[model samples]
Target: MPKDTILVVDDSPTEQRLVAAALSLQGYRVITAADGEEAIEKAAKELPRLIVLDVVMPKKNGFQVCRQLKTTAATQNIKVLLLTSKSQDSDKFWGMKQGADAYMTKPFTDGDLVANITKLI
Candidate 1:
């Protein structure tokens, strides 16, 4: 199978590296962004198959980015997975409402992460 690229958006360097490494180990081409604005720019330019987004970010938030990406025709088809520390039911609801294809919490196992990525991309 052809390798797929995944964009991981997070303000925390540790989280960013952790996710990137996990995805890379699974043979994915991992790209990263430190903020939501950068995420949007990279998403539009790189056109990755999937984006792992964080809810709280600078410049823009994951929900905002997800909404814009989903509403914009050019980038709407890219699958968005909200991987965040927010575990509230309301947050998950809001994320899904904002067009996130999947909502996952932080402290996630590599197994679950890969499973979600496999299902999405």
Candidate 2:
């Protein structure tokens, strides 16, 4: 079977590049978007199997993006994994409420990130 593609959305070019490379190392195709607008557009256009989104981005945040993706018919079924710095319990609860499948804080290990992606795929 072919490896699934992952759409990674983050404002920091450094973060985006790091994640893209890590996922690529696992043999999955990686696509990137700089902000929430691009993330939404790419999610619709690419329809990736999963999305790795960062919170606290300009224009829109991960929570809003997750809700939008879940509410939209075109991208409703796609799994969303929020990778952000929001560590509070309430933040995680809100993320789930917004329809994300998984939420992880920043400074996560590559193994955990890849493991989450693998499990979801």
Give the candidate number with the greatest TM-score. 1
Error in Å for residue 86 of model 1: 0.5
* CA error at residue 25 for candidate 2, angstroms: 0.3
> What lDDT score belongs to each candidate, Candidate 1 first?
0.96, 0.94
- When summed lDDT is taken over every stretch of 10 residues in candidate 2, the lowest stretch is 1-10
Q: For residues 1-121, write the lDDT of model 1, one tens digit per residue.
A: 5389999999999999999999999999999999999999999999999999999999999999999999999899999999999999999999999999999999899999999989987
Q: Which pairs clash inside model 1?
A: none
Which runs in model 2 stand beyond 4 Å of their true positions?
A: none
TM-score, one value per model: 0.97, 0.97
Candidate 2 lDDT score at position 113 = 97
| Global lDDT of model 2 | 0.94
Q: Write the per-residue lDDT of candidate 2 for residues 7-104, one digit (tens) a residue.
A: 99999999899889889989988999999999999999999999999988998899999999999999999999999989999999999999999999
The collision pairs in model 2 are none
- Candidate 1 regions exceeding 4 Å error are none
